[model samples]
Target: MPETVFEVDVDAAPEEQPDPIVNRWHPDVPPVERVSPGEKFRVECLDWTGNQVNNDDSASDIRDMRLDPNHHLSGPIAVDGAKPGDLLVVDILDLGPFPDNEWGFTGIFELDNGGGFLTDHFPNARKAIWDFDGVYTSSRHVPDVRFAGLSHPGILGTAPSHDLLERWNERERDLIERGPDDETAVNHETHDDDPPLALPPEPNEVLLGDMDDEAVEEAAEKAARTIPPRENAGNCDIKNLSRGSRVYLPVFVEGANLVTGDLHFSQGDGEITFCGAIEMAGYVDLKVDVIENGMERFGVDHAIFKPGNVEPQFSEYVVFEGYSVDEDGTQHYKNANVGMRRACLDAIDYLTNFGYTPEQAYIILSTVPVESRIAGIVDLPNTCVTVSVPEAVFDFDVDPDSLAEISSEGRGRAARPS
Candidate 1:
C-alpha cells in the first residue's frame, strides 16, 4: 500500500470524498497533490458513476443515471518538473477491489441514455451484479459464467494543455454539430446503431475536485467530457492496463496533471455494453516517472501501452464471427462498427441456445474477459469481426454435441429497470 493520496468511501458522493474527484478534464483544474518522479502512490476512486448505480436486482438506478459528471477521477496530481514535450511514464503497479466491498456491476444503459454498442437489440437499462471471490467473479444475474478479473482503471491520463483542451473541444463540437453531406459520406463511419458520435462537455453536474468556485466557473464549460477517448487517453477502457502495465502518456502541460478513475474488476474488449465492465470503486497503485522530451523522441502523439502479465488463463474459446452488414442485411464496406455489432449479436444468439437469456449473455460478454477482435478491417467489401468466449467460464462443456445444458424453459430476461 503506497501512501494513499486520494481516499474515498464508495457510499459517499464524489464531492464528499477525502479528496473530491473531478468528472471532466481541464488543464486549469488545480492539482490536489504533487509527487516527485518515480514516486509510488495510491488513489482511491468512486465507481465510474460516482455511486449512482447500485448492487440490486432492478436497474432503475442505471436507467435514471445522469449522463454528465461521469468517471469521477481521483486526481490531477502534478508530477514535479514534468512539462510539455515530455512523456509521463506510468506503471500500473497493482489494482484490485476493496476487501470489504468486493462486488461490482456491469450494465446496459438505456438506449436513450448512454446507449451501448448493441443498443438496438437490447434497448432498456439492465444490470449484472458480480461478486468477487479471490480474483474470479460470478454474477447472480447471469448464469453458468465465472472468470478471473482483469482489473484496471477504465480511464486515466495526463491533463491536456490549454491549447490541447481547445483542440479537443473544437473537434467534439464539430462532430456533434456536423450534419450529413458530401464530406460525411467520404469520411464518417457513422451508423444509426453506433455509440454517440461525440460527447460535448456539460457543466450542469461538473465536478472539479476542491478547486474554488471562481476557477470552476471559468473551466467547467471548456473541460473535455470523459465519455470518449481522445489524444489524452481519457476513456479508452483498455482491459489490459492491469497490474505491471506501463503506459507512456503524452504530456501537454507543466507538471503533467495526472488523473485516473473508473476502476473495473473485469471487462471484455470493446466494453460493448457502454457501462459494460465490472466497474468498482477501488484503488490503483501507481509509480510514475518523467520522460523529458520523450513525446518527440518517441514520435508519440497518443497514449501507448504494453499490457501486464496478469490475465485470465482460459486457453480455449467458442468463437463467433460477424461481417459488416446491418441487421436488415444492408451491405456495408469496411465498417468495423457494424461488424462488431453483428459479432456481439451472434454471440448473444448462440448463448440463448444453451438456455441463457439474450440479456444475460449480453451482460456476460460485457463483463468477462472475452476477446473482441477485429479479424479483418481491410477485407474489401466487408469487414470481419469476431467475439470469442472462454470455454471454461461455463460449468458445462461448451461443445454443443457432448454435454447437457441449462433449460431455457424457466429462464427469464436478466435484470431490468423497475
Candidate 2:
C-alpha cells in the first residue's frame, strides 16, 4: 500500500477544546445562533457515499446502495443568532484524509451517465472503487493507472428548517419511485459559452469523443443555478478543502446544520468518474463558528493553500483565489477578479510566522486557484462555496481568523510568528 503522507509545514499550534453549543454533533441536536466573521471548523468527513461503502468493495455492492446512519455528518452546530437572510461563513481550516490511502475516490460522475455531454458514447453505468494501494478498477474496465482517489464529502450543508427538511426528506424517499424521466423530477435548462482550458492535457487519448467541448460548454450553463452547485460543488473535485481556504455556508435553521461524509484522496478536474479520489475510514475534526451577514452579491468564496505551495485553491474548479478582499477591503478588484492570491496570503500568514514578501507571494498566487469564477451567485438569499486542495501537499498552523484582522496593506507587517 502506498503511504498517504501529508507533506507541508507541520509546525502549526495544537488544537483547543471545542465549544459545547457549536461543537455538538447532529443538526437537530442544537439550537441556532449567530457566529462572528472569521470563525472556523475542522470538519470530519467520510467517504463520498458517507462511508456506506469501502475500499474493498466492488461495483455490485454500491449498485444497490443504502447509506448507514453513522456515515452522514458530524454536526449541525448552531451559530448564535444566525437567522434568515444571513450567510453562515464556514472557513474550512483543513480536511485530513485517511492516511491509509494516499488519495480518496468515490463513485458517480456528472456527465458520464446519459445525463451529460458524452452520454451517447459513454453509455455504461459506471462504478468507482479503490483501495489503499492507490489502484482503481471500474465497473467494466481493467485497472490501468496507479491513481488513488482522495475522498471529500459530496454533501456539506446546514439542515433546512424542520418543515423544509421534512419536505425534502419525503421527496427523497419517493425519488426512486418517481424515476428519472418524471417531468416533475427532471428540470434542465441549457445555455452557451464556456471556460478556457488550463495546463493542456499531457498527450492524452481522444477515445472519449468530443466530451471536452461538450463538457466545457454544458458545464457553463449548469453552473448558473444554485441547487446544482450544492449538488456537485460547481465542478469541484473530491480532494479539495484541505488547507488555507475556508468554506462559507448560509445558516438555515438555528444551528448551521453541518455534515461531511464524502471523502476523496485525489480527483480529476471535472471529477469525470462521478466519484472522488478514494473511499476509506478517517476522522474529521471541526471548530464550528460563524461570520456576521456573510451573504454578498456575486456569491462568496475563499482561497486555500499550504505554505510550501504558492498558488491558491478556490471553492470550486472555476474560481481563482484572491478574486476579492478578505473582509479587509484592500486587494484590487479585477473585472474577472478571483481572490486566490489574497487567500494564499491568508493561508501563508496563518501557517508561517515569517510571512512571504509581496513579490514571492504574488508569483505563486497566480499559478494556482485555476478556473476562477462564481460557482453560484443566486441561491435564494445567500450563496456558499468551498476552497479545495490535495491533502498530501498541504499543512498549516496559524489561525485564519487573524488574517482578517490586519489591513491588506499591513497583513505582511502585522503577521508575526507566535
Candidate 3:
C-alpha cells in the first residue's frame, strides 16, 4: 500500500474532513499536500454527493441531490519542480473500494433536478444498489446480472490559470444566459432542459479547501464548477481512466495543483443517466511525474490519456442499433446524443424480454460494462449508433429470438421516486 496523503471518511460530510476537500477549480485553491516526482501515494475520496445519498432502497436521496456542493475533490497536491506549459504525468497504479463498505449506487436523477442524457425519456429519479464481491458486483434491486467493475476516478485535473479560468467563466456564463436552444430542448413543456445549459462560478455552495475565511467569498465567486469537462479534464467521466492508465494533464499554474475525486466502481460508455455509474467512496494509488515543455512538444491543448488494460473481458455481445431520430419521430441531422439515446432505449426495450422492467433495464444499461459507438458518422440526416451489451453478464442465454418470455427474474424493482 502506498502512503495515504489525503483521506476522508465515507460516512461523514466532506466539509468535516480533517484535510480539506474542495469542489471548485482555481489556481489559488491551496494545495493540501505536496509530493515529489516518481513518488506513489494514495488518495481517499468522499462520494460525489458527499454521502448525502443513503444505501437504502429509496430514490428520494437522488431526487433531492445537491449539485452546487457536489464532486468533493481531494486536493491541489503540488508536485515539486512542475511548472506551467509542462504535462503532468499521472500513472493510476491501482483502484479499490473500502474493505468495510463494499457497496455502491447508480442513480437516475429526475428531470427537474440532475438532468441526464436521456432525461426526457426517464424523467423520475431511480436508484440501484450494487454490492461488490471481489471484482464482480451484483445489484439486489435489479437482479440476475453480475459483472466485473472497471474502477476509476470520475473527476481529476490540474488547477486553471487566471486567464484560463476567466475564459471558462465567460463562455459558460454566456451559455447559461442564452439558455438551451430549440434543438437541445426538444420538449418545452413537461421535460424541460432543467439543469441549465451550463453551470457558472457561483458563490453559493462553493468550497475552496483550507483557504482562510476572508478570502473564501472572493475565491468562491471566481472558482469554476466541477461538473463540465474543460481543457483541464475535470469531470470527463471517461470510464477509461482506470487502474494502470497513464493520463497526461496540461499544467497551467506552478506545481500542477492536481485535484481528484468522484470515484466510480463501474460505468457504461456514456454514463447516460446522470449519477448513473456505480458511485462509491474509494482510494486511488498513483505515481506522479512531469514532462518539461511536453504540452507544446505534443501540441496538446487538453488532457489526453492512455486507457488501462485491466477491464473485464467479455466474449459475446447482443448489439442494438439506432439512428439520429428522437423518440417522437422528430428527425435530427446527424445528432449523436439523439442517436445514442435511441440505442440505449432500444436496448432497454430488448432487456424487458428478460423479465426486467423498463426502469430495471435502464439501470442495467447504466451500470454494466456496455459498449457504445458511432458506427456511421458521415451518413446524412441519420448517424447510426450501436450499443453492445455483453451476453455473459446474464445468467441465461441472451438470445432474444430463442427466449420469447422472461427467462430471468429480478430480486425486486429498483427504488422509485416517492
Candidate 4:
C-alpha cells in the first residue's frame, strides 16, 4: 500500500492552522508536526513577500513595503528517525496556482535601496503582472512573450546544530565589528516579541515547548537572517529545482528539522534586481527520507540537488561580454561586480534597440532566465564576464551575427578588448 500523505496549510488562521511558518530556521523552534521517515506530505506556502503585495498591487506598493526578515517559510517538520550527521533527502513533487487566484507579479527594486545590476541606468520601481495558463506564463509588461513555467521552492533547508549556530554568529559578528560602516550589519532582533508573520505554531507564542534552558538560549540568537545561501540551504534560488528534483541537505540538528517556503512560480538565474520574479503562494508536495553519514561519504558540506526536467532550450544565444579594466588600463582584480554591471548595461542597450525602454529592458533582464557566465579570468589585465539571453524567447528571428556586432558597438562605458 502507498504511504499516507500529510497536509499542512501555512495560511490558515492561528486557531485553524495545522503547520507553523517561520521566518528564520531555529533548531529550538518546536516542530508543528512530525513525520516518520520516507513519508509523503503537502505544504501550502505563502509568497516570498508573505502575501503583503497582491496581484492588484502597484509599483508604489512594492516601494513602500518593508522586506526585513524576508522569505516566510513553513514548518520545521521533524523527521522521526533523523539525527545530526545524517543527510535529509527531499524529493520535490509539485508546485501550484495559489489558494484564491491564478496570478502573480514580477517587480524591480528602487535604486536607493541596495540597488541591483543596472540600478543606475534604471532607477524607478516597476511591477509586471503575470497570468498563469497551464504550463506557460504571459506578461502584459513585455507583450508577445510566453515562456514555460519553471516553478520551484526558493528556500529549503534543515535547522542548524548548536555548533553550526555558534560558528555563524561568531563570523557574522566579526564581520560587523571589522566594518562598522557597512550597511549589511547583522540585526540582533529576537523572534520572541513579534507576532508570527505568516503561520505561528499551534498554541501560539511557545516555540520551545519543554526544551532545556541551553537550547532555548541558543534558539534566541536565531540563524543569521534568511538571505544568503549557506551549507544548510536557505535561499539558494536555483531555478532548475522544479518538480521531480531531489535535493540532499546536510543534517545539523537532531531529527533534521526540515523547513521550506518562498515558492516562486518562475524565476531566472541571478534573481537580478531582487524585487521580483513570478512571485506567488502555492502548495509543494515532497517525499522526505534520510541517509546515514551521507555528508562524510560524499565529501560535500553543502546542499546538492539533481534537477528534474528543467533545461535551457535555446540552441543559439546572443552573448554580450564585459571587461573589468578601466579605459586607461587600470586593472581591478576580483572586481567581478563591475564586469556584471557592464554586461547588464550591454543587455539593456541591446533590448532597447528592439523597442523596449531602459526600464522594460531591466525588468526583462531580471525576470528572464538569461545565463551569466565568467568567461575568462586568466587574462591578467582584464577578466571577462558574459551575459547570454536565449534567442528563442523572442518572437522575431534573431541573427547571431548581427547581435554580435551590436554587442561590440555599445559595450558600456568601459574600454573594449584589444
Best by lDDT: 3
Question: TM-score for each prediction?
Answer: 0.93, 0.42, 0.94, 0.81
Residue-wise C-alpha lDDT for candidate 1, range 240-303, written one tens digit per residue = 9999999999998889999998999999989988898999988899999998899899998999
lDDT of 4 by residue, 187-273 (tens): 223233322222221221223323455775565455456666778998887888888899999999888987787877777667777
Task: State each candidate's clash count.
Answer: 0, 84, 0, 0
Q: Looking at candidate 2, what is the lDDT of residue 292?
A: 55
Once superposed on the true structure, which residue ranges of model 4 sit more than 4 Å away at CA?
Answer: 1-18, 112-114, 180-221, 326-330, 398-418
Candidate 3 lands at a TM-score of 0.94
Regarding lDDT, does 1 or 4 come out ahead? 1
> Which lDDT value does model 4 have at 300?
89
On TM-score, the leading prediction is 3
- Model 2 misplaced regions, further than 4 Å: 1-42, 67-71, 100-152, 162-240, 286-289, 296-418
Question: After best superposition, candidate 4 residue 11: deviation in angstroms?
Answer: 7.5
Of models 3 and 4, which has the larger lDDT?
A: 3
lDDT of each: 0.83, 0.34, 0.86, 0.67
